[model samples]
Target: MDWNERYSEPGFTYGTEPNEFVAAVAGRIPPGRILSLAEGEGRNAVYLASRGYQVTGVDGSEVGLRKAQELAAERGVAITTIHADLSTFEIEAEQWDGIIASYCHLPSAIRAPLFRAAVRGLKTGGVFVLEAFSKEQLNYGTGGPQSPDMLMALDELKLELAGLDFVHAVTVERDVREGSKHTGLASVVQLFAVKR
Candidate 1:
C-alpha cells in the first residue's frame, strides 16, 4: 500500500493532536536545535516549535510535508521541513540537541540502520525520544504497520539502542488517541535516551 496515498485523506490520519506519550516527555527536553523524524502532518514538530524549539521535520511524503507546513502556519510557528526517505536520509552528526521519533514505522531491516543514523546525528548529551507501536499492537486494530517485522519490540529496541544512555524504556499497553488513524488500546514502546 502507498502510505503516502493513505496520508492524502482530507482529515489528519494521525489526528492533529500530538501523541500523549510524546507530550508527556516534551517538557523534559531542553530547548535547542531539534529534529523530528517521520513527522507526518507536523503535529509534533509544530508543538515543539511552539515551545520555542528550533524544529526541523523530515518525512518521505510530500503530501505529509505540505500538511505539516499548514499545521505550523496554523500554530503560528515556523518549522524547517526536509523531504527524504528515512531509509537513506542521513542525519547530520553532532547537529541536533534532540531527536523525536514518534510512530516511525519500518521493517526491522530498515529500522536498524535509520535508528543508528538518528543516534549518530545527535550531539553529545542530545536527547532521543521515541514512541512506537509494539508487536502486541496487532491485537488493538488501531493504527500501525501490520507486518510483524515492521512492528517494534522491547528486546529489539534494547539491542538497537544499546549504545545510548537510556533514561526511560518501557513496553506497555496504553490508551492512544490521536488523529483518526491511531486510536485505541495500543501496545507501544516509549524511550528517552541521551547520546553518550
Candidate 2:
C-alpha cells in the first residue's frame, strides 16, 4: 500500500490519542531519549515528548511524517523524526533509553530482525514497550492487516526478544478505539521489557 498517498489526506489516519497501552505504561518509564518505530503520524511521539521525554519518531511515509510534525507543532512539543522504512532502517547500538513499537506489525522475516535491532539499539537497562494486534485480530473486524503473516503472536515476540527481561507480556481481547481505522473490541498483545 502507498502509505504516503494514504497520509496525503486532509487529516490524520489515526486520531491524536496515544495508544492506550502506551499511556498506561507512561509512568513506569522514566523520561529519557526514546525511539518510536513505525510511528505512523506521531501521536505517540508527541505524547512522550509532552511528558518530557526526548522522542524520535521513525516511519516510512514522508507525508505521514509531515503530518506528525504538524501535530507536534500544534501540540507545542518537539520531536525528531526519521523518514525511513523499518525494513532497512539501521538502529545504532545503545542509542536509546526506551523504544516503542506501537502497532508495528510485519511478517516474521521482517519483524524478527527488527526486534533484534531494537534490542541492540537500546542502552543497557533500556526498556522496550510494544502494543500490536494479535493473530486473533483477524476476527475482530476492527483494524490491522488481514494477512496472518502481518499479525503478531506473543510466542513469536518471546522468541524474537529472548534476550530481554520481560516486565509484562500478555495477549488479550480489549477495546481499542483510535481513529476510524482502529476501533471496537480487538485482540492484541502488549509487551514491556527491560534489557538486562
lDDT (CA) for every model shown? 0.88, 0.91
Stretches > 4 Å off in candidate 2: none
Runs off by more than 4 Å, candidate 1: none
Measured against the true structure, the TM-scores of the candidates, in listed sequence, are 0.96, 0.97
lDDT of 2 by residue, 104-169 (tens): 977889999999999998888899999999999999899999999989988889989878999999
TM-score of 1: 0.96
- Give the best candidate by lDDT: 2
Report RMSD (Å) for each prediction in the order shown.
1.1, 0.9
lDDT value, residue 184 of candidate 2: 92
Put down candidate 1 lDDT per residue, 89-192, tens digits, no spaces: 88888899999989988878888988888788888888889999998898889888889898888788878876789899999988888878787888999999
